[model samples]
Target chain A: MTLRANNIEHFYGSEHILHNISLEIMPKKITAIIGESGSGKTTLLAILSSLLKPTRGTIYYDDILLSNIKNIDLFRKKNIGFVFQFHYLIDYLTLKENIALGALKESDNIEELIKTLGISNLANRYGNEVSGGERQRAAIARALVNSPSFVFADEPTGNLDTKNAIGVFELFRNFKDTSFIVATHDKKIIDYADIIIEMEDGYVKNISSQRT
Target chain B: MITPLKALRKNKFKTALIFFSMVVAISAIFLISAISNGIVGMYSTMLKTDGDIIVTQRGIADTFFSDINYTIKKRIEKISNVKEVNALILGAAPVDNLPIVGIYGVSENRFDSYKLISGIYPKSNEVIMGQKIYKMLNSPKKIVISKKEFNVSGVFKSKIGFEDGGVVMRLDDGSKIFHKSTSIFLVSLKDIESKNTITDINHLNSDIEAKTTDNFIDNYNQFKIIKTSSDVISALAFLMGVLGIVSMMSMVVNDRKVEFGIMRSVGLPSKTIIIKLVAETIIIAIFAYIFALALSYIVLEIIQNTQKFQGYINGEITFSLGALIFFTSVLMAIVGTLLPAIWASRVDPMSLILRGAY
Candidate 1:
């Protein structure tokens, strides 16, 4: 399903964070939201994920008006996924349990996801015990565990080294059928995006479609 | 579940402090409740003597010190449903300069309930001393009755409060020794269903107060317990228990803010997170309860062995059914955790991700 944010305006208290932001995130494609610091890239992404309510305008997940849905949790859990810059894995849980949490239902293939993330050896380790790169991979595995229709990642590769960041970007690109909207300042990720949206001062500056 | 537990494990010192605080609070409640129950049980059992009806003089001020005339005893025996009526006289008497001996006037035939440990019922003006008091008086060679000496018949075991501190004698000898005409009466009813019999007896003599023995004993025991400072102790115990639960719950919830935030960001509802927290608190409380029981028993045992309280100071510790303590502690923990959990759930994922707080 295509994710659309139309003329969205967001405010925290009385301070406006995003103003008249509009964008469409296509299914089976990767969309990058690029902006300088304080450009409201994260705020815009949060509104799309339903983690933050927009003060004005509407969001539609395909034909469903997300703004009108009463139980955003059900919609978010069933269709939306999130990957944060820092992995917020539960420190008490093993990597496998942390990944499986996103699914909300236990599956034997949770170990397969851990293995695919090259974190098989770290499966039994606590979140705090793993390296940052391993933690990021585990975070990705967690986001994809539910096989959600869309994923919203806020600077997922921001904390990683060049090699680790490239690895994560490739992982994002490999999920061919799942749509992704990544908010970041990294130009390297812009090259891999099917669509690029630029933001300035909480407003969309430009939107471009890249020919693969 | 994993997230919260991990957070708890990571901050081992903080978690342990919170856990210990919870244990102390829960244990305090458990200990107080157990001791209160133990003391009440002991007193109630003492009041459950074999008599169905016990008659005491009306408006005599002090029932223990009131005198029931021998003629009145005969009159009570005439009432229907009253199979037998026995007069018992109780007073304080000095034993070997120790003001601890209780003097009892009992009939020879109905003295079997005393369960003579090493002596027979007094035959003549002889007297039987309680084992504890008998031992305390260094097992006196002879107990003087009506200024006449009689050999100590034997030590007897009694579960009654009056018997706990002294000796028993025949009513005739007791009256002459105390220089009083008559005292208390213990009446056994053949059938408790005959409530009208007591009313009729009361009507027959407005000056006489005839009551079901159970009610009399209950009232008497309740009066004694209230007078003996048990009520104050029980109230204080209950208050401490409530406070302990509240304190523990607040501490645990306050310490786990980030853990709760992690759970919320993963799509768990605020309610689900609360349930888990309450469940965890209950589990902790259960552990504390067991610990409290053990500790109370140890304390009671030490008190019994060292201080030697005459009343039931050390009985088995018992927790109330209906999961009252468990539910109360859990509820307190939930209330304690609620605000913090809500605040944690409301944390914006953007702030958490951008600030790298998680």
Candidate 2:
């Protein structure tokens, strides 16, 4: 079932940050959220992921309303994954442990994922010892390891150089069966989207569909 | 659950600071507790070392100076629960021009409890000295007194505190030397329940003070031992514990602010974030506890061996089994981490993205 947010509103103290945001995220499709700075794009994504609750709206996963679920952690673990710009891997753990940490249940085949990501040689090294590209890749690997229905990336390649940014975007593109809502201002990231959503001043300004 | 050991390994300096503070806190607690235990133990041993009930002269104001009628020794034996009674005399005597020797007189048969490590119990006019006193005398072969030379019996060990600095002799010898009736009656109770018998005796002998073993020991402890050291040390330890938790948690919260923000952004609930923060503190506390225990053991061992503190300080090495300290440390860490964890969770996702903290 697809994830849907209806007329979501968010606030910061007495200040309203997001207004009347509605969106539906289908499974196995790429949906890119593009916006200028302070456009509430990240807030909308956060609300969809259920990280932040909308003050005056309803969110539903399939027909089961998310706001009614008592166990948000279980829902998030089962249905959602997240990647951030800085790739906040625990510096003490090896790459494998960092990736496996995202999964609610343990898997014996983490080495397979490491091999798939071509990070087998770097698996034993600490997160601090790895390059920026490798760290970003590890974050992607962590997000995907949970096998959630959707993956949310908030400027996932924001900290990377042009080459690493392209590589990370390619990795996101390769996960075709996992819905993607990547928030970025990177033109390269925008060009690779199947559905482009442009946001400004806490509202959706433009949306366009493209042939994958 | 994340292994705090691995986390601590990543931040060695910070971990060391936290560990140091924990050690200080635990050690202070250990030291204070040990002293309290030690004082109580010393008094208990003093009472148990002699007899069940000690009858001292009333109105004398001090047990050391109180002189009881030696005939009361026979009268106490007739009391219910009294198994045997002995008269004892305590006095100070010069040893090699040093006034450090405490003299005690007892019946020859009652010397069974006195374990002689080097010499035998005194017979007739002979005297047995304590190990420390004997050593202080440079292992004299004989001592002359009152125009007579008495052969030294073997050196003996005593569990009583004053005996460590004195000599023990038979009552006849002590009477011959001091020319006075023994001052105290040491009465052995037939069983543990005989404490009630002593209460009855106190009722009967209105002019005398009859005390049970514990009461007698407690009185002696109040008079002889210094108090307040434990309270002072415990207070200091508690303060250091609070400081340690505050500093460690503050730094940890600051370092993990972004991580907490991201967790909040990704649909992790606030309650879950709070639980995670508390769990992380508990994890850190466990590490600190283990480290503190190990360090306390090592430090205590070194103090025990180097300072020869067996008699001076009661630093018994013991593992902390009580959850109070553990719970207290975790509570402090949680309290310390709460404000920052909440602050991080409350960060606006849009602002975080704009400021590039996420």
Candidate 3:
């Protein structure tokens, strides 16, 4: 079973943002989306995450069509995770509380999860009190804590410095069994990819395979 | 649920701003309501007396303007179930330079209703004054009325605001001073037979009007005008409070749109998000109401200590009115917050996510 988008098209009030976008997200693989600004990378990520519906397309998770599901939130809770450029950690919450916020299903060993993310020492601190890199790690922990099948990240290291960016990219390398669909512009992020999807304007410009 | 509280805590300045604004708005509403209730309560208590019903000139809303003939009093006395009818000369006496003083002329039987706090009832050519009037006269031993010097007989107190500032004199003297006829006739019915007595009194003459004491007290021309205007103003104040809350809620919702977006993307259902927002609003409302009630009490106490509202309240407070004020404040909060929360929840997460590009 895999996540597939077939001939997905999207419009922002007649301005074509995504034109005939089609892709397959396979299991246990890291797929990287590389593009410049306004190239519709984030838009495609949003549509594929089912946070949005494409204007013209069909999205299938495994054998089930997304539109046929009665509860989209429950589906996303069970199957998808998201990490954004700014982390968007809730300012008032401690790191543990932030990570546990959307964990609808049980996961094995939350302590281990925070420990693995290197945020155990910072767990009691509020999101804003931590450094940028720490907040990004906390965001990743939150997305992965519920043990979703796929994690989608949009410019996950955009705000971090080179060292922190490399740290974040390397963190993705350790999760080879979990599918990652990341939209980014950082070449360092692209180096760790198993599959590279390059987009220009609203169309696929190139698709390349990486040795990993 | 916890998210909203956390958000409020995080935005300390905004939360405090909302709390303070609501406190002020709710306090205004409480003051308006309390004042109106106080006025009505004082009047109602003052009007409560030995009379079961009252008779005055038809269409004369103010007893001071009433000129019911003495014949009507005699006629009412003859009616069956009539216990006793007491006639009064209600008028005002002029001071040398001060405001005109309310004067009530009564007999020994009518004088029993007012508690004489100090000294005896007024002797011939003497007058018992209310505490307010005594203070105004600087505790004078004697005062002049209509070119005659009369001794200050005593001080008396009544629950009624107007009566608390009045001069009580013999009916003959009141007539000589004000130069008017009988103003009002108080009828005490025999053993709970007030309805039939009132009907009998009404049939005696079309020129005379008869009504229960409660109705007469509530329908006083001055009280009616003041109550109507106060009620209208209080209603307006309540409306303005609701508007203030609505404006505040709009700002809160606008500022928290991204938070809502983040929650939505994290798979929080819209219903749950709305619930959390509404819960936060209710918490704020409850706190505001409590603070407003306490503030209103303090302000009312201060107002009572001032000479302006000394006799105006007369120790009469209505809890139902307080409850009404609280209920309205809470309702305003819910209406203000719920609509905006729903709107914020419906906002597209993608739009909010896209908005952060800058």
Report the Cα lDDT for residue A85, model 1: 77
For model 2, residues A8-111, the per-residue Cα lDDT tens digits are: 88887898878888878777877889989889877888778776678899999899898898877777867788887778776777888777765665545567
Candidate 1 chain B least-lDDT 10 residues: B307-316
The residue-by-residue lDDT of candidate 3 on B1-358, one tens digit each, is 5667777787777677778878887887778767777776765654456678888899976877888777677788888788888878877766444456677887567887879899889878999988876776688888876677788889997756667777888877776776765787888888665777888889999988989988887677787786788778877766776777677777876777666777777777788778887788777878888998889888887876566443555333378877887787778777777777888777666665666434
Q: Which structure among the candidates has the greatest lDDT?
A: 3
Better of 2 and 3 by DockQ: 3
Which CAPRI quality tier does the interface of model 2 achieve? acceptable
DockQ, each predicted model? 0.39, 0.28, 0.61
Error of 3 at A166 (Å): 3.3
Interface RMSD of each: 2.6, 3.6, 1.4
| Stretches of model 1 off by over 4 angstroms after superposition | A104-109, A209-212, B1-36, B59-67, B89-110, B119-153, B158-183, B217-255, B312-358
* Candidate 1 lDDT tens digits, B31-121: 5555556555554453345567766778664555667677776777787778877777766666555644567777554577678888677
Identify the leading candidate in terms of DockQ.
3
Instruction: Give the top-scoring candidate (TM-score).
Output: 3
- What are the TM-scores, per candidate, against the unseen true structure? 0.82, 0.76, 0.90
* Predictions in order: chain A TM-score: 0.95, 0.94, 0.96
lDDT of 1 at B140: 89
Model 1 over residues A1-212: C-alpha lDDT tens digits? Answer: 98888889988789988988777888888889999989998889888987767889999998899878876666676687788777777767788877876575643557777777799998888888888899989888887777778888889889988889889889887777788899999887678788899999998999999955
Better of 1 and 2 by TM-score: 1
